[model samples]
Target: MFALYSGSLAEPGDPNPYAGGESLVLPKLWFAGYRRMLRVRIETGPAMQRYRAASRLN
Candidate 1:
C-alpha cells in the first residue's frame, strides 16, 4: 500500500538523469552499494518517526 520513489529522476529512461541543469551520473556498480546503504537507513529510520509521532505519551 506504500508507494515510494527513491531513485526517481526527471527522466524515466535515465536512472541518474540531469537535475536542476546539473548532470547526475552515478556509476552502475556504485549504485548497488549505495542502494543497500540507503535501504538500511530507510528501514532504521522508522524509529525516528515513531519517537516524533508521540509528543511524550503522557
Candidate 2:
C-alpha cells in the first residue's frame, strides 16, 4: 500500500518540499489491478461474514 500526503509539515520550520506541487507516478496497470482487488474484497465481504456466522452455529 502507498500513502499520499500533502501540505504536511515535519517540524515547525520544515515542510514537505513536494507537498501540493508533485503527483505520484504509478503505472496504469498497477492501479487497475489494485482497484480490481479492492472490488473483489468488497464484493466478498458480506459472503465471508455469512460463512463465519454459519461456522459459529455449527
Assess every candidate by TM-score.
0.34, 0.35
Q: What ranges in model 2 sit over 4 Å off?
A: 1-26, 47-58
Residue-by-residue lDDT tens digits, candidate 2, 1-58: 2322221212223333444544544333334445555566766789888998999999
| C-alpha RMSD for every candidate | 10.9, 10.7
Error of 1 at 34 (Å): 0.7
C-alpha lDDT of residue 54 in model 2: 92
Q: Which ten residues in a row have the lowest lDDT in candidate 1?
A: 1-10
lDDT for each residue of candidate 1 in 1-58, tens digit (9 for 90 to 100): 0112334212223453223433234444334444655666665687866776775774
